[model samples]
Target: MSKILIVEDEDAIRRVLKKVLSEENEKFVIDEAADGVDAVAKIKINNYDLVICDIKMPKKDGIEVLNFIKKFNQEINVIMISGHGDLKTAVEAMRTGAFDYIEKPPDLNNLLTSVRGALKAKVVKSGIKKNKSSTKKGKYEIVGESKKISDLKDLIVKIAPTNAKVLILGPNGSGKELVARQIHLNSLRSDGPFIEVNCAAIPSELIESELFGHLKGSFTSAHKDRTGKFEAANNGTLFLDEIGDMSLSAQSKVLRAIQENKIQKVGSEKDIYVDTRVIAATNKNVKKLIESNIFREDLYHRISVIELNVPKLDDRKEDIPDLISFFINLISAQYDKKNITINEKAIKKLSSFDWPGNVRELRNVVERLLILTESDQITDKDIVKFSGK
Candidate 1:
């Protein structure tokens, strides 16, 4: 979740911006300030991910507020709101470290774009910091020996060496990401980066700009030339998750890119060639989506060069013991605890239930057992207490 601050003296503009931004993303927690002084007082108290400030206010101006935030917490991004005559001051504020500035009667698209970009930048920075302290973990393993899983492993080894556009079908939390990572690691492009995009998470209006790069002046808030995922994942594997939810407009452009091995930026006519391998995944049935006219048939055929269906946990219940053992050790180490052994009766109890949420939910239950259970060994009573029953 992202916390945002809107600092504008005008009640009408502040209320409108707050309403629109709240509607844009439900995860946003928004706060409003009537003046720069009030904004500074709140900034000192709450840790905001982004701030939208007005330049000309009755009290302290936007530049002062930006300076205060930069001095207080340089990581918090600020987007200045400038009037027609305040463009020069806005530019100065940018030089001082504002993320971007919007003119009065702000373009809805530009404001939203700037806000999204700022939040995304903060998240990337935080992730990088976390990764720096993390241990060098080994490759992601599909932790099951069921016949279905074994067959999937054999198929992955055969297809990974080739640059085939593979489509993976599975229910949510059935390890679709794990499968994609395994393929990328075994593929010829293992030396390159593995980029993953959740199609359902990005809004339809910004999908094009997110995939294909945009020029500095392409949109009202395109402050600088940006590299999109296609360019970022060049000579690597681009994993598009939840592809069935992508808008048809973006789907056509993606189809063009796959067909020609080239993609034009959002506002450019010239094409940029890329040697990218695309792997797509979706939980929905594409054939049904096509019949409903929600998904493009040509795009579906193009991406589904080799379709791999991952079985849900219910179908592979035979592997529950191995999966339980794997998660016990994996999650226990994260909490700095010794590996807690599970009794045979507890394992049997876990295996008997139907897991609609699949491996993801099971892992959560294991973690809960590790933390909440009193005994070193996980027994039937432990399973009953914290195994998500």
Candidate 2:
């Protein structure tokens, strides 16, 4: 059922509108608000598919309400209503992002048709939201039962709901990116975009434009206006991987964006405000960088409000057995091969080695064993040949 809110100060018109909307379809669950203030309060508490707001009302007007909806809930369709047929106000309403405009005494047929059309749009938005939620499930799984892994999972659950800036710390190939992604998956902005930028991968000269964007023809190589990661991640999560590798100049700009929630394009002075939840990961020792005057101390403090350290595979050896089995099934499915069994001795031998490269290295070794082994099962001999002990 789609919920609709009717914002009108007049009780009689409100009742008639409700009657007309109720007669349209049984799926329409309607609510009435006597004024704009009441409408906004209801909007804050409940999710409405469409709002029928009066252009002129007490305490607040339709334009004010429309702007508020655009700011917070862009998905909701709004239909502006008024007794006085003012073309200017109707045009203003449409320009301000109203779905449609209907002058009162609303033609029953016209109103019904408009309402149905607006409701169709609502259905489409809901379907997109549903598909996004489905995609988010099982997208990033932190596989392990060790105390270290469990503690990290607990911390993620506690902090994901809030818009806290997270700093993930770990060695190279220690699954820091995985931890950052998991945090994004569980966050309030899960339905929004997840923008990832690899600081170390991009050249220092182009990193500024890569992050803050630039206007076309503003620079020598500029051909098209580009939207940066921050704008791309507006109302979503931005994962800055290998953040310690970001240039000091870029770090200062990033610090400003974090402080003000606004960023300027590389070629433009106009500030663009973005509601991006930043989750930065770094394998490099940022404190040492700070002491060396390469990384800004203030920027470091800004991004590390919630620090999470991923445990190295050597430190969490209890998880090796589970990791091996996970990779076996995962790799087997990917390669269209039936998963083979690994004997106890093989497991023991694999777990005994010091994995300097962490979980990432273990996954690679498991896949190598699956592909290189001749028998139906991975045995102690396979481990002796493939496990670089």
Candidate 3:
């Protein structure tokens, strides 16, 4: 259970926040404080996983409370509640160590999503060890025992200790990011930050700035000096997902960084040397892209020092049952539902189909079934009605 403290001077708002959280998930053990002074007192005595604090408060303000927490326990995530007038202060509070901020009369959806994300990140930041033998799994835990998965696990164990760059190839939703995360979590540099960038998501024009950062007035929207992924990931791991989608110009810059462990800001001549481990992943066939002149061959060679291919669901269907069981437990906890049982016929039916979207699709189907099905047991009919496969 996650212990959350709702700190608000307003009685009604505090009550509403507690109500929303408790209704969303009973597992949230919530406490309340009327003002920042009480909040600081409670925080001093209580171990809270999250704090929902209003930006404007009596006695002590949210910023002061946030500073206290940052100094007291950096692990505790604070979500600032902001009114219209407090927006600027809220942003500053975020820079001051707030996890996220929600506007007044909080959009419940955004509030809940932020809460979940903050809690999830808290787990990752806390560096909790995964129980390899248990069904209760971390988001990045590799959950399978098939020959291919077994071999993949073995390879990760072998390569994780080295500073070798890895190129992970797989279909979309095949858990490529999970593999990248596992590599970082088990590596010698596990204590450092793990920064991830989706090359495909950013525009080609901004990709360079996104990776290498920019100085004040570097571009039209470059308001101030910004740190890029390469710099942020210094002395850690930088995961470049969908490298196949990266532009040739950006690819050349990436190659330079990989070859020389140095990067330049977009509007600066100064070189910043960093000891960052690069891990790249792509769903596309990189070699074909190379032949088509879309991806750089030299960059490819540098990143492919250790190649790891995450198998698609069809290639590892034998692991579906295990995956299903794992997801059931995972999604159940996320939704605050009791663990539901899946019949053999349901599991068999699920395994029979080719999951075009791979493990990701399967998890969605499981979540769907858990929500749509009325009974505690999930069967083939539930699969038929909800799986959408």
Candidate 4:
């Protein structure tokens, strides 16, 4: 369900908005305000998913309300309703952080579409914020007791307090992200945001905008101004996952951002300064990439101030029993099932198989076995059948 606010001076318009929105979606909880002053008061007192306000209102206009809400709660989406003559003001409203602008004498479809889009965008932004917060809850706590794990934790504790860049080397699914989060959690800028960008996931053509942002009208499809991860993570950490997959051109820009704590958005000449700690992780050998000239050596040197290597699941076989127990408890809770036990024979069999997908693969196998096994105690037979042994 989405909570929405309708701020308009005219009673008829306000009532019409409420009726249209309510009829469109029963889940929408719509609130009305006579003007900007009333809207601001309501905004402060309540949490709303979207706010639609008329540009010309008595006492406090929509622009004032937009500015106040942006300063207080940037997460809340706003849509400005303006008269045909207020087109200039509407554009200004967008510049001042309104999600979008709609001409007055509202078309039902246009109003509904803009509101729906704003709500969907709010949901995505909220999800990202939640994910970031959840990732930060225990940035330093390494969840293992093995000697290798303990040593890594100790190293992280010692190195995390510095502004030094860290290069985390590990195999796929080896918890490299966990290591990166630990460094950020323990760093001097722990309170600041920790933004993550997957270099491999972003297309090479769009990687620049993803990192440094883009100006309005910077390129085709750039309908409005956008902030990049670098700007968003100012005074914080930016974790670049799969850095080895980043293109040569993107690597140069990354190098510049590290060398000088400044970046120029695509199609913009002005440099935006950011105080960000860069932590990069890769499953591939960066040195080999440099040797092949696919990855820039200078950038590698800039980001590799300190390097931490996470061992693969095979190398950490001693931790298998503990890992199995941990997964069983975690999976059981998540699936709403009672905890299952792993027999000694099953443990031995698991230890023997080479986990090509590392810890993630192990977790999946555990969940599968838990679902398929008839007995509460998992044995070698269950492992063999499920694991394709």
Each model's total of backbone clashes: 0, 0, 0, 0
Where's the lowest-lDDT run of ten residues in candidate 3? 128-137
Prediction 2 global C-alpha lDDT = 0.82
By TM-score rank, best first, the candidates go 2, 3, 1, 4
Q: Which stretches of candidate 2 lie over 4 Å from their true place?
A: 1-137
lDDT of 1: 0.84
Ranking by lDDT: 3, 1, 2, 4
After TM-score superposition, the amount by which residue 66's alpha carbon in candidate 4 deviates from its true location, in angstroms, is 52
N/CA/C clash count, model 2: 0
Candidate 3 C-alpha RMSD relative to the actual structure? 18.5
Cα error, candidate 3, residue 283 (Å): 1.1
Q: Which portions of model 3 miss their true places by more than 4 Å?
A: 1-138
RMSD of each: 20.0, 12.6, 18.5, 16.4
Candidate 1 lDDT over 130-197, as tens digits, reads 22123121558887878999888877765564455789999998999998888887655778889999
- All candidates: TM-score: 0.65, 0.66, 0.65, 0.63
Top model number, TM-score: 2
For residues 1-389, could you state the per-residue lDDT of candidate 2 as single tens digits? 89999999889989999998888887788999998888899999999999988888889988888899888797898888855556457656665567666768776654675677578756655555432233233746778889998888777764564455789999988888888887788655777899999999999988989999999987899999999999999878899999999998899999888756689998899998777778999988999999999999988866876789999999999999999988898898887778587999999999999999999999999999899899889998998898666
Please give the RMSD of candidate 1 to the true structure: 20.0
lDDT of 3 by residue, 219-307 (tens): 99999999999999986899999999999999999998876677999999998887788999999998899899998887886788678
Which residue pairs clash in candidate 3? none
TM-score of structure candidate 4: 0.63
* Global Cα lDDT for candidate 3: 0.85
Error of 2 at 349 (Å): 0.6
